[model samples]
Target chain A: TQLLEQSPQFLSIQEGENLTVYCNSSSVFSSLQWYRQEPGEGPVLLVTVVTGGEVKKLKRLTFQFGDARKDSSLHITAAQPGDTGLYLCAGAANTNAGKSTFGDGTTLTVKP
Target chain B: EPEVTQTPSHQVTQMGQEVILRCVPISNHLYFYWYRQILGQKVEFLVSFYNNEISEKSEIFDDQFSVERPDGSNFTLKIRSTKLEDSAMYFCASSDRDSPPEAFFGQGTRLTVV
Candidate 1:
């Protein structure tokens, strides 16, 4: 089974702070996706990085896929209270019907 | 902004009983998937369905779990028998492409087996 591990399981920061969360794995995947989930809701797709060393920006959030496709990172610039949520990274194998392997997730809390 | 939709936001069933979760994926999406997350745990992939059949499924999707796209738009997951451990939030998602498979998920069905 392919596993994705996320660091700093819980994070709390004041508004306007910047924080970075990471997702790592020993397996290489064809694509990696980042999602944000609110309480009692399913995860919403944030972004998908398909190429190695690729970077994508969604307003205040920046996502990057490692060169080897075994890891990814999410960075928030001047995080606001609205940015607080559970951030998850999922890796999809090239084969296996494109099923994604998810990380435990990093729960971020931005206090206003 | 199209989105997936799931019915019966929450379900409560007794152990050994059967349950069927329903989902209506985005109209144009061709790939549908089901995933579950135990409280405070990671979202685990359960099954993927395409072309009216299952394409792939995780080991967690044992014989007790089954999926069917009975109609063109409605996808359903049936658990033959429920156990306490089966309680979790079940999410239905769909995507148009496969390269990255950027999926959109529904609000989810919270299933509790008592």
Candidate 2:
């Protein structure tokens, strides 16, 4: 089983502050995805990085995939209260079949 | 954007009782999956279904847990006998292709076994 470990299990910051969450694993992955889950709801996909050293930007959120495909990071700039949620990173192993393994998750709180 | 839908957003059942959680995945999706998140814990993969059969399943998907696609649109997960440990938020997700994994998840059903 592949295990993805996310750093900064809990984070709290004032609005407009910046923060980065890290996801690391010893096993290599074909792709990595980031998700944001609000209270009482399922997770919503934020971004998916497939290539090594890849970076994608969506508004104020930036995601980066490691060169070895064993780690990923999500950075939020000028965070807003709306950005507060449980952020998760999932790593997909190269398999003919199956869903990806998810990390423990990072709970972020952006105070307005 | 089209999204997955799950029925019975919340369910409360007694121990040893049977429960069925329902989901309707996106129309174009070909692969389906089930995952559970215990409160304050990581999301765990339970099973993956494709072509009307289980393509993969985790150890957590024991004899008590089963999945079915009763119709073209509805996917369901059944727990034969509920236990206190089974209480968690169960999410149903779907993906269009298997090569590069990108799954869309439903709102999830929160189950409470008392």
lDDT (CA) per prediction: 0.94, 0.94
lDDT of 1: 0.94
lDDT tens per residue, model 1, B1-114: 898999889999999999999999999999999999999899999998888889899999999999998888899999999999999999999999877878899999999999
Candidate 2 CA-lDDT value: 0.94
- Model 2, B35-56: lDDT tens digits are 9999988899999999999998
DockQ of each: 0.85, 0.75
TM-score of chain B of 1: 0.98
- Candidate 2: TM-score? 0.97
Model 2 spans > 4 angstroms off: none
* Superposed Cα deviation of residue B74, candidate 2 (Å): 0.5
In model 1 chain A, where is the ten-residue run with the lowest total lDDT? A93-102
* TM-score for chain A, candidates 1 onward in order: 0.98, 0.97
Tens digit per residue, CA lDDT, model 1, A4-78: 999889999999999999999999999999999999999999999989999999999999999999999999999
